[model samples]
Target: MTIQLKQEIDKVYEEDYLLWLEQTAEQLRQKDIENLDWEHLIDEIEDLGKAQKNAVETYLRQLLKHLLLYQYWTQEKDYCADGWAEEIDNFRNELEILLRSKTLYNYSASILEATYQKARRSAFKKTKLDIFPSECPYTLEQVLDLDYLPE
Candidate 1:
């Protein structure tokens, strides 16, 4: 692509992203490789992968937070156990949807420890309880299983 045309495409990406996306799709479908916004396209594709991984990490952390509450927060167990369990199921379902990709599933497993630490901190902040484990107590399988609830 000429420098002028490339600059115009990049400007469109910044000024009107939806228009740029539509135009980019048309360019790809037409196989007009010469005019394709290669730089922005590559960045967007990479961002898509990262977005999937980030979503899985987020859901896993939420699941861990609720699991800790349900399993260890004795003071409010009678009042909050069922709600926390429900949130766990919801997060599990969301994680399962995002984890359909094997890459994302493995990514979730890899980030488990780090995500759990964040969850533990969040739980402590909410309940002012320091009783939760320092490390993750549940494995990836247990967290993903719909039927599994930590006792």
Candidate 2:
């Protein structure tokens, strides 16, 4: 199953992998690290998590493997140009550590916000409940407004 999922991801993002690598390297070259939007990357990671939640660990391992390969490929050329190799190596090490620590499921607020926006868009397309939903089964405000029963 893990192998099959890896294959699927490889097929789906084969082009994206290269694009991300190029974009990442370019961002590094600009030395605008502080402005790099890790949130967008985290959202992609979260999307991967959603796709493979059933096999989170396996998916993360495969992702880490692919990321390391990407780093290697990107760094292999001009390996000695302005410490790029070291930076790529550091990224590879960090990816490995993240995979080993099973931290892929952890997402930042921006990631959640992006994901939620996507979900909301989908839900809106499906039904009007997205705009006006029914009342809650246990409204916290209502309960809080009521007097408590004797303990």
lDDT of each: 0.92, 0.40
Residue 133 lDDT in model 1? 94
- RMSD of every prediction: 1.0, 24.0
Strongest candidate by TM-score = 1
Q: After superposing candidate 2, which stretches have Cα over 4 Å from the reference?
A: 1-17, 25-31, 56-151
Compose the digit string of candidate 1's lDDT tens values, residues 46-76.
Answer: 9998888888888898999999999999999
Q: Name every residue pair that clashes in candidate 1.
A: none
- List the candidates' TM-scores in order: 0.96, 0.21
lDDT of 1: 0.92
Candidate 2: what lDDT? Answer: 0.40
Best by lDDT: 1
